[model samples]
Target: MLALPNYPGDGGGLIVDRAADAPRYEYASLNDCPQVHPDSPNEESTCQHALRDCPPEELGPLLRIWRRTVAGDVVLEPWDSKGLTCASDVAPGARPTLTMADLKAQFMRTPWAKPQVSSQPKGNITLVNLTTFYRVDWSTGGFAPGEVDQSVLRGIPVRIRPKLVGFTYVFGDGTTYGPTVSTGGVYPKGDITHVYRERGEFPTRVLTTFGADFSLDGTRWDPIPSTVTVPGPVTTITVREAQAVLVNH
Candidate 1:
C-alpha cells in the first residue's frame, strides 16, 4: 500500500494497494495514462485496469489523486495532467517565479480607493475666472503611497507593494491637469487649483496611477515592470458669472 500526498484542495490523501496478481504497467508521466472517455462502453474498466496495475514509480511523483466512485467501485485518476512534478526536478530553496505580467494582473484586481475630490469656496457653485482650489481628500481614500498585499503562489509566500506614481485631474469641460505627484492641498495653499474661463457645469475627477514592487519568500524587494491606473469618482462643479448689486448702508 502506498499513500500519496494530496494537493491544496484535494480534501484527503489517496491510499493505493496493488493486488498480488495485478499486471504491471509503466507510464513515464501522467499524460501517458489512459484518458477516460465518458461515452465509451469500457470507460471505467479500461482506465481502472491501468490505474490499478500501474506502479507508483512508473507514474513519477504524484501531487494529487482524484478518486471517483463508479457503480459501487472505487476508481482513481490523476488530478491534473500538468500538476505532476518530479521531486528531483525542483531545486531546494528555489523561489517561485513572479513575472511582471502576473504582478500587473494582480495589481489591476486590487480594490484601490478612488480619488476624493474637494474644492474651496465650499459649494457646488464657483465664479467664472475664479481660482477654484481643488485637492484630494486624503482621509477619504485619496492615495495609497505604500500599500501591500500578500498571498501564496505556487506554494511560496509572495508580497506585493504599490507606490503612487502620480495623479491626473480631469476638470471636465475639456480640460485636464495632471499626472502630477502632488495630492494638491487646501483653500489658500492648494497647488491643484483650476480657474474656470467660461462659466457652466464642469464634471471633474482624478485618476491615480501606481507602480509596484514584489518580494518572494520574504526576500528583498524587486520592482514590477508595469503600472496601473485607476479612475476616481466624478464630482460636478457648477460655475456661474458673479453679478455685483448695489446695497443701502
Candidate 2:
C-alpha cells in the first residue's frame, strides 16, 4: 500500500511556505510532485500534486486545500505546444503541489486556477433601531464599527459562532477624541456627527464581530489604521484609516 498518511518524515515537503513566491526549496521523496523533477528519477516532487491532481485515496489527510493554483493569475502549459506533454512535466512520481505550480507556470493550461478556500465577511450597511430611546441612553452607547477584511478575518466561520470585535473612530489630529456620534453598527439608521479638528480623508472602518467572537481561540484584534490628509482649520473633516505597519527585515 502506497502509505495513506504523509510519507513519515515530512509535513508535505516542508509545506513550501504556501505564502512564498518561489516553490519549495527541495525535492527527494517517492511521492514528490511530478512536475518538479520529472526527469530526475529519484527527484520527488512536493505536495503540489497530491493536493491538486491526485485522487482522494492518494491524498491521505491534507485534502482540505483542494490544490488551488493561485488566487489572481492564469496557468499555462508549454508542454502542450511541444506535442510531447513537455519532457519536464508529469513523471512517475512527483509533488502534487509543485506539479500544480508548474502547470500554472507554463501559462498554457487553465487561465483561472481552482481554489476551494474559506469565506470571509461581505460589505453592507444597515440602521440600528433602538427599542426604547429613554432606556438606551445616547451617551453610554455609540455605534460599533461594522466591517471585516482578510487582514483581520478569522479561519473559522462567523455563521457557526459570533466573534467579539468592534471599531473605533479616528480623528484628523492623529488621535481619537470624543464627539457626539451616532451609528447603527452594521446597519445605518441616519447620519451621525463625529468631530474631526481638521477637514480631510479620515479612513472610516468597522468590525463585524463584537470582540466576543467564537471563531478564534485568542483575541480577534485588528489595528484599524488610517492616514487622514486633513486640510487646515475646519470642524467638519474627512479621514483615511490605514494600518501603518513597519516591517523590520
Highest lDDT scorer: 1
Listed per model in order, the count of residue pairs whose N, CA or C atoms clash below 3 Å is: 0, 54
lDDT of 2 by residue, 1-249 (tens): 222212223454434335444222222233323343323443332332232344323322112211212222432211111111111233212333333223222222111111111101112111122211100111222222232221111122221111222223333346542222333222133232233333344333321223211111233332211111111122222232334599999
lDDT of 1 by residue, 1-249 (tens): 232333223333532553433322212222112443233342222112222232344432222222322222333342232333323123221122323345457766667767678777788578998888888855344336576788754344567777888999999888898889988877778898889889888888899898877765445666665688888888899999999999999
TM-score of 1: 0.58
Which ten-residue region of model 1 has the weakest summed lDDT?
Answer: 24-33
lDDT of 2 at 21: 40
Candidate 1 Cα outliers beyond 4 Å, as residue runs: 1-98, 138-143, 217-219
**Best-fitting candidate, scored by TM-score:** 1
Each candidate structure's TM-score, on Cα atoms with residue i matched to residue i, is 0.58, 0.18
